[model samples]
Target: MPEPHLLAADTDRAAVVTRLDESLADGRLTLAEYEDRSARAHAARTYGELADLTADLPLPARREPARREPARSPVASALHGGAWHGAWGHDLRAAWTGWVTTAVIVVGIWLVTVLGSGDLQYPWPVWVIGPWGVVLLARTIGERRSQDTDRQQLPA
Candidate 1:
């Protein structure tokens, strides 16, 4: 069942080896069969010879192409200090702003209720603000530790 016509003049060693491996992996070849075919494939002289090695094997679905990292411009890379561009700074600032907004809103509501009642009400604002304050504190500490780690990792 080998397509003898598909075999041509130019064939490389890698192609032959690949086909033999495929045959082995596809279970078309037992270990002994693989070894024998692999030897023959290595000794193969032309494209036809290599094609014969895998002619009986079924082709598997193609795999996704490998990922490659995005290329960075030299000037932009230098300007951003390799790893300092976004790391934690923007996030920390936003977190602080969020905490301030929450605190102001809770206190404003609590103060209105207290003054309107003509007596100091229970400090109920603490209930709303305490949990948010704890969350922001933890986040700030985590960011500081992470930045310290990143700074340590940088080359001398």
Candidate 2:
């Protein structure tokens, strides 16, 4: 048996219908599509029938629970973990890469201005360009940190 909160039948069916109607009225759903699906959902007598009405809608793919048994070998476990782990690791690495690349460019410009035979002066091109590089690096890092914080706050 499922928990009462998890059962659709235990919910306010009228409220669900009202939400669907609002979606249609707000242009989130086309009138023709809404009417057709709403009619199907209304006429449904069983859980399966109601599910079928919205089966064609795109939904976020669910992650399958890991198996506890040894039906799968150790290699399968390693491979499964590696796929998603690598993707998240790459994302984190890219953020650092951006910061490092920006810093290198800034340093290169500063060195050229100081060591090279050029009139290095305040309010010059290098002064303006150098700080912009650091600003970009800070912005990228801050944005990524904020996004990570937001993701952490969301319910899994």
State which candidate has the highest lDDT: 1
- Residue 15 Cα positional deviation in candidate 1, in Å, after optimal superposition: 56
Pick the TM-score winner.
1
- Provide the clashing-pair count of each candidate structure: 0, 0
lDDT of 2 by residue, 1-156 (tens): 133334345243443455555555444666567667777666655555555554554443465985444354557746764222222332443444444555566667767877775765453545645665565566556556756876999999
Number of clashing residue pairs, candidate 1? 0
Model 2, poorest ten-residue lDDT window? 82-91
- As a whole number from 0 to 100, the lDDT of residue 99 in candidate 2 is 46
RMSD of 1: 25.0
User: lDDT for each of the candidates?
Assistant: 0.68, 0.53
